[model samples]
Target: MKPETPFYITTPIYYPNAEPHLGHAYTTVFADILARYHRLIGDDTFYLTGTDEHGLKLQRAAEAKGVTPKEFVDSMVAIYRNFWGLLNISYNRFVRTTDEDHIKVVKYAAEVMYRKGLIYKGNYSGWYCVDCEKFYSASEYLMIDGRPHCPIHRKPLEWTEESTYYFRLSEFREYLLNLLKNKDIVYPKHFRQEVINKIVGQELLDISIARPKERVWWGIELPFDKNYTVYVWFDALLNYLTGINYLSDKERFRRYWSSTHHVIGKDILWFHTAVWFAMLKALDIDPPKKVLVHSFIINKGLKMGKSSGNAVRIEDLLGRYLSSDGVRYLIARIFNLGKDVEVSTSLLDSIYNSELADNLGNLIRRVGVLIKKKLKGTLSSESIDNTLTDKADTAVHKFNKLLGEEYEISTALQEVMGLLKEANAYINSVRPWELSDPSKELYTLMEVVKVAINLLYPVIPESVSKVAESFSIQLGNPLDISVDVGKEYVVKEAPILFKKVR
Candidate 1:
């Protein structure tokens, strides 16, 4: 990828009916890491994340709270913004479905679809999951204790019938099947297979695109019909287009939309790959360049939920760690890209102590102390060590390859830590403390540390910044493994990067 090339990516807009949890933070943080990596390598990157505020669920929850839906969403959105700030999420834009610009684009898309004969007047009768704000047929819901309940939420399903506008989703059945056949539509082949089975197994029915305005008054009103409101899902999906100002700014939209990626959870694969892609085809627009589907973060073999008392709050986890970077480090280290990960406080503590505090932190502090004491806090430039150079090159190459191809974040971090362990072993073998003049050996050690920090800057921004400051090097240098060996380096007094937890 060239520096001038553009890269656009997004995390699905969270449904803010409740507080943010580990699942929400997980996806957003992963997107941020990729965006940062693109920027570090000099790409024009745009990263977006936000909340979904308007839906039947939001209206019902707001009524129960004795406040209007807008007021309720306003308070809930603040919570999401605060948590993302605490975790240092680097998103270029925070888009909400209710924003004026976003609303305009969504309405524009609905109107365009209606004009293309892709949407038509229809009636719908089925089981509706109010919690998910989605409609399900009989086969989609599960039977529980003689009554039908939503498979996703495990709550009683509501039987409802209404006059609705329907999108001709079935018309795109073959279109979607052919689209999914392309490997770039969804990664990790297995997930793509799941999508294919879903479309093939179930009869592809035309989906409802509007709800009677008298019943759900909080959503965007349909431009063609005064008595109905655009379906929340229709409005929500347009957010991807909103990132480039699809309705108002044409040139900008073309620039970014040409190559776009979506980071989503496994649960929403059908929504993104099937429905979202179908809508794009109806509009005669190209589908997103790719979709990166990831698994959930669970506890005790169950998905994290507030009612289950297993959901871990971002604030609670951050408070337990020495720095926010510690929390970020552990999550990225333990996260399995395509499988669910079980998280516990004990697991977090153990990983932090062993890899971060013992291996990585110990290396930085030891090297910094040696130079400050023996070499008078000054480093003389020396040719890069061949052995260490090979190790650094291999780590950087592996990191880039994994992130670019497999999206294997945890595995990438393991490779970087492997390089750090090698550096630590070199220190013990050379025993630089015994050398009256250890400038050359110390220089190599510092170079290794510098390379490690640069590679990790995307994952742990705060801690890496502190490391660069201690060595008096400019942060955000172009991505590379080579250090500036000709320039004299100065070491400064700084606090320990990671403190060992008891």
Candidate 2:
């Protein structure tokens, strides 16, 4: 079936001031899973992920490393690409803010906003959170250790006075509040409420959108002003447009941007739902179709970060897992939508050993072995028990409804695990290996196992491929619960899908 409507998804362009961590991997993995699910269901899907290379953070880090900002970003971009490649992220485009086309579109957006009287020159005097790269109003600043600090960054704020251009965010407060409350603009009602309280419950400030060249020399120069550069957030957000070449390719942009979904961490939820949405409205473009905000990955009960000294690198964690598929599976299983998940070596180890190796993988190994020994590596047609058929149908329906519409992955995996348990129980009850005439029981077992592998493919594509190949089966639409081992097929000798680890 051809895709009916395009599903364009984006993971927040990670700020590459540091290496990619488990927190970063969580967002990208979630986006990849959603993209893959959409693709399997026959949606024309496009996934965009990349680096935000221009910011005070990038500039400061570059200067500290004694390299130009451009050179630093170039090297960091390579690291990001390598990491995503290792994890098998199937994004259609990896955008960089420094790209020529991105700069062009950012300038275009700024010019259009400026002409509409939505941007103006102003002097900003407030607590500047260098870590967040945004200014906090007096009321928004938190007092810590008797000094004003940024609530999000937990760092002392710098009192700065600078003349910069500000975007009229206050003008869109009502529009943003209505958008959040009335539309399916953000997912998981609680997160939407968080935005509503911020916009409607309080004042929305006019955000500064430019930094003087003398202060920050590593961003897109404003089209109307030569002495200033676009703020990093402003420049970074344009990638969603430039990633699809919005300015030059109207058709491509329309096809993808018509229904855009953003996957971002909760820390930046306000930026997407408020600042970015307001910018789009100011530019006369439609707001994104939906926003999925995820909670941070924590370590030792603290959010993982370099400053926290608890950051877990993706590469280090990948080493313990047998394959990238295993790593992705555990992360998707570990993270719950809209809530924090603590990361640890032992946690992943246990989940992988019990779920993948012991439960799912063990079932696959048992099925392959039974078919090879009892049926002489050949499968014959048999009547599937109604009990097994109903189970398969229910699993497929729930998996589709949960993962597809509700975005409840953890629950979907629970459904898959339930089916796996049923398969195990069915195998135990029939004792196919011991029965003198075991064709029907073995055939039914294979069908159950086939459907389980199809459902697991979105989370662990590569590993599931091995399972499918071993049984001479082509993995198709996960929603297709039909048992398709065919009338008589030869099964290949198979290795354990996941090796048991201590």
Candidate 3:
């Protein structure tokens, strides 16, 4: 068999009905970090994130704002782009369902199923949540706060009726079961198990796949019939493939599609891992290779949503915390991969001060400060002793093996911080501050400090550049990342790298 090629990953296309929130921001940033890492490590990686701009949600949001659905969705998509930009989310492609290529792919997908008799004209009358853009089963409606609420969005469910087209999802029960049996379908093992227990273990129901154009005209029109538009999920999910022109760009798609990983909040896991797999199998296409399911971000132990009026806006975090890496690090380190994690201002402050400032930042300041002290503010090439090279090599090897090879990001970050801790301990033990003649061992201390900055660059990118300035080293590209301690050395000492915020 040919060697499996490179890695690709994506955040779920977000609904553009509301302002961006931390719940949404957290997902994209985590995906961005993984994408950045894969690209840095030389994978032919593709990272896509964008807005899903169709469905009842868009229609209703437009009505509330006294505008056309197009205007409403356009404004919402802009918020998503700006908010993500603030977070430094490096998305390779910001695909929109409204994009012509995406529209064509969704139509093509619908046509294929229509030809197979897998789509049928049907009546859909049920409790719909405009916020979720989904119809809830009778069992799913909640009576919390003395009202029938959407379990996912916690808003009152609306009653509606209309003629629609439905995908013969029941027809794919066996196909989904067989696909789930294939272990490579979704990754990290635990996430796959959740899909099995929840999606496959439950009876598959035929899904409503198109909306009557009269009711909601914001989506791609079904090619088989012009009276209806494809369901928002049907149209939006295809952006993953259509973003790369999966059908049109055969060779290109073949390279990245199978290695693709979709990082989504648990709310949409069914659509991504299950329904997406069924659709691909029906079209004789490969399903996304992995789905990394994440739980929600709660605030003060309560779920945050629009109606709750407590949604933590993305701008709030970015504005208050100039600590961009600090927020990213806190989310990645504290979140339990497959379980809900809470967020609060206090929690954010704690992680910023405790992890980034006290730990990583303090380490950088100490080493760079000491280097400037001994070398008289100009780094010396001979300030590094060759004897300490082995220890540096061993530490970097252990971290790279865990982070790059094993996909253990949380463990990897912990290990990266461990390297910083070791360096701080080295400085304390060597007491370079006490060195008057500054012997060969002082150079050994410089070598150790230099190695710590190189290894920590991938996680805290900005700080690395500053640390490089102090060492008189010019890092070519952060993406051209290097963890090799013995590779090359540039020793020119400058000032301390971090200034702690009061």
Tell me how far the alpha carbon of residue 392 in candidate 1 is from the true structure, in angstroms, after superposition. 1.1
For candidate 3, write residues 1-502 as lDDT tens digits: 5554478888888888778777887788778877876766567788898888888878887988999988888888888888777677888899988888888788888888889988888888888887676678778899887768899788898887778888887887776767777766565567777777876567877888887777677777889888888878888888888877677888888788868888887778778877888888778887777787777767764332232467776655555556566556666676556567777666667667766777777765665566556666443444444435566666667767765655556676776667666666766777778877553454555555565666555555666677776566654433333333333334454444333443
Question: Which portions of model 1 show Cα errors greater than 4 Å?
Answer: 1-3, 127-159, 301-308, 476-478
Compared with the true structure, what per-residue lDDT tens digits does model 1 show for residues 1-502?
4447789999999999999977788888888888988889888899999888887889989999999999999999999999898889999999999999988887888889889999999888878887776677777889999998999899999987779999999999998888888646687678989989999999998988888888888999998888988888888888999978888888889889987989999988888989999999987888898898888776664332233377777776776675778878887887665788877667878888878888889898899899899988888865656688678878888888887667888999998899999999999999999998888888888877877888899999998888888888666543455655766778885347788776
**What's every prediction's RMSD, in angstroms?**
2.9, 3.1, 4.2
Best by lDDT: 2
Model 1 score (lDDT): 0.84
Tens digit per residue, CA lDDT, model 2, 411-463: 89888888888888888998888987687887887777778778878889998
lDDT measured at residue 64 in model 1 versus the true structure, 0 to 100: 97
Q: List the residue pairs that clash in candidate 1.
A: none
| True lDDT of residue 245, candidate 3 | 69
* lDDT assessment of candidate 2: 0.85
Summed over model 3, clashes come to 2
Minimal lDDT window, size 10, model 1: 299-308
